[model samples]
Target: MGLGFGFKGRIVACAMSSLLATIAAPVWAAADIVIGQVAPLTGVIAGTGDEYVAGAHAYFAHVNAKGGVNGRKIRVVVKDDGYKPDQTLALTKEMIAQDNPVALFGFVGTANVLSLVKNKVLSDAGIALLAPYTGSLDLREPMNPNIFHIRASYTDETAKMVEHLHTIGIRKFAVMYQDDAFGKSGLAGAESALAKLGLKAVATGSYDRTKPEEVGAAIKAIEPASPEAIIMVSVNKASSAFIKQLRAAGSRAQLYSISVVNFKELLKNAGEEIVRGVGIAQVMPFPYTPATPVVREFQGLMQQYAPGKVISYASMESFVAAKVLVEALRRAGPEPTREKVLAALEAVRDYDVGGFKIGFGPNNRIGSRFVDITVIGRDGKLLK
Candidate 1:
């Protein structure tokens, strides 16, 4: 038998109580700064979501250890939405009513975040959401003052990938995307980028987000074109399945993915041999290389805080985003409000977080437009 309504209600109540307790406890006496995060903590994409939150927490730990911003420690109250938009909206509303987080951070999916924006939750509550994980161009359109983006858009990532492929004389293109808001957003971006170069995808494929294993339809759609390369706008599980199936079908098209796919998860799901030679457009600095000061700092902090966790692009992006948020908090003064934080974020212009540069303006919500392409090498390692 399935869980009854009463049982389900009890579960939800328990979750809400636990979330409240986490925020209320650990009294710093100076009153710790609270931030809320609603993402997929338990679902197909939970691994990536966990790493993102872990990365933000690692940075917050670093900041708190250094006395925090204005002598107040930062604490994040996290709630799991399980990659469901309705759950994201509900959890966010509950967080706002109970915990009263000054800002929302590190939300995972395009549909999940869009639910909040479309319903006027951010504007109605007047809370700023910083560094949501999705790069969909939809978020940037019309410029919601309550939401701030820290990474490059999907458009930027696709343009960079397509432009690089064009330079190498690989003109015939195809796209395989997840069939949802996130997927469609990336597909649109890829098409737009190709159109700018006087070209279009030779083929396109889309698989259901919930039924990633059922990719025969997608394969059938894209196989006939026999394009030289394919841009994949999907997360780990679906992408891995597609790669395995495509390879089994004897397709030799070079595969590329966006930054949203967790490299470690892809390696784990698809194995080193299957994921080998796949290119991915990165929105953040390479974490393993330590070529940049920020990357080195991130590596050191990950060691100190999240000892056993493997450094990854998702974590690196979150770490950098947390740093930007903290910087903005510092500028928001000792007694910070949501409006003050938003103003502080807008005031940031060409601010350097070690080596990585981020800038934002009242008219420009995007903090960075940096995109670099990388490939999977031997032993499931990324080659720059």
Candidate 2:
């Protein structure tokens, strides 16, 4: 079992530059709290995981610069899981035995988390998993005390989009989803939402998450339905490829995606022209819009620490996760422990991270239920 650090060293370096005894003294006097993250640093969904890790890094860096949480700086240790559940399971075990971090933070993928959960990895190790990237009902159902989620669930995102699409007079819905737990969760949500309105997807297709080339087969399934619009639940590459192929095949079906797809990466792969007017359900406030106070802080911190990084919803969601984690740490006080951090997180309620709010309690770990919908405009920006 071996371990590596991602954003911790830089945060400490930034903290030390102050040289003021108050800030510098903490480096020596305070205990450093280490947290582990398992994400896909490579593979098709790589961009989503990479961007989110950068966001968490940016926010943690900002907190460390301001003297950290209760004087103890946070160290985020990251390992690449390659977006594979098996890899996520392996890395998580290594993280527990090797790194022994206080908690598992910002882990990506529904299938990955489910693998960890199903095998009793976190519960067996007695460590909390905080702010997982994917929001599956599987994580929240039966209430696993060790897991805390910051963003809205796939249910929330899909339900909102399906309802919005229905409200806009588009009745015939088609779905193209990845063949995995994440995609199934989104599909379930879409079905539930549509059921509430006495509607259903006219056509649906599933593709393997690991194979972008397989998206062509799913498109073949969706095109024959001739639905008015299609709801997609996939990663950046597969979904981007799906949209490009669907367009090339002369289908005018409106494109809609769940929040898990990174629009920035989608734009890069599929281009603005193909993705223009594509609807996406988002769980975080748009980073480009400074109207939300949290967006301003996130953007400022990203610029300072992750220079030249594109402000993306993926990063913004992780920023929220990092901010909430720091707040929980601060509330846990100076001599923080795994139990204390979990207790503090549970005790959190109506805590404001700038304009947005996060809530948790003894019986609840659902941080926020906020979800929004946006469309990619012709100008290469998300429009509300």
Candidate 3:
């Protein structure tokens, strides 16, 4: 809750990732550029943060290996917030007040980011928050110059899901979401999407994000309506539990989720039997695909830097975010200031990073509109 040891304890080296004390060895130099992350490293969402940090560090390691990013090595200083918004606010301020990172990158959760924005912390400091890892529409609506998002909005995702399901003639939708900003964001998106199609959700359910294991009641709450499709806007633990319990309760509605739900964690929490045929929208392209240059490059980097770990959307999204951060820093020229970096980000437009394109102009922080759907195959892995 306070300045715990995990603050700045997470070390992402050029060669690899480490959690051990850096003082024990001669590693990072004065020339290395540091980025800060306030993430969940000690809660149910820990694996999500881990995968994201791994991806960002792995990409940075690749960049460092190739003569660094504009002759400066990249390092990430991470703090564990246990997915608590208050902890995120405190540690984020500490990260800025103490570490003096060039940028604040990859903070997870809608509420955490909302806390920062509500207090005007990042904007007040002139620090840019690149890709805070949530698809909340509130972040995108008012056009905060300090925030830049690389993924599709929650509206883009849920609308895509609803549109696809509607095209396939499956209406009668229900929603199960966390009782929080993140969940309500998806709920609003679904509502808008359904409204656009002249349809409405049959039933909806809510569960506490912190008490994710209490998903049985939420599942039972939606059973009576018997929707043909259940749109889920929650994280891995509760979403998987809902799916498991819904199936156990004999509700045969096909389950769908937004991109924020980590499919790997879902698979780990709910086995293949319960998760089969469940659809989830993805903002990032399939990481396993060889055709997409960015994904292929990400795969190669994961092989070299994170060999034993599995490739996931969280990591892949972080890798892309790292690439974007590096490019913007590069554009800021040598000896870049945070203000210069902000200016550089504002100028980005239709810039291609490998296969995908990310663009941001003045008054527009939404980078990409790409969204796709994937389903869990019978074998437990998500299929495109």
lDDT (CA) per prediction: 0.90, 0.86, 0.88
Q: Write the per-residue lDDT of candidate 2 for residues 115-188, one digit (tens) a residue.
A: 99899998888788888988789888888999998889888988888888888898999888888888888889
lDDT of 3 at 169: 96
lDDT score for residue 116 of model 3: 96
lDDT of 1 at 52: 91
Error of 3 at 170 (Å): 1.5
Clash pairs, model 1 backbone: none
TM-scores for candidates 1 onward, in order: 0.91, 0.91, 0.91
Looking at model 1, which ten-residue stretch has the lowest summed lDDT? 1-10
Candidate 2, superposed: residue stretches over 4 Å from native: 1-28
The most accurate candidate by lDDT is 1
Residue-level lDDT tens digits of model 3 in 142-240: 888899999999989999999999999997999898999999999999999999999999898999988987887677678999999999998888888
Q: lDDT ranking from best to worst?
A: 1, 3, 2
lDDT of 3 at 5: 45
Cα displacement (Å) at residue 166, model 2: 1.4
Better of 2 and 3 by lDDT: 3
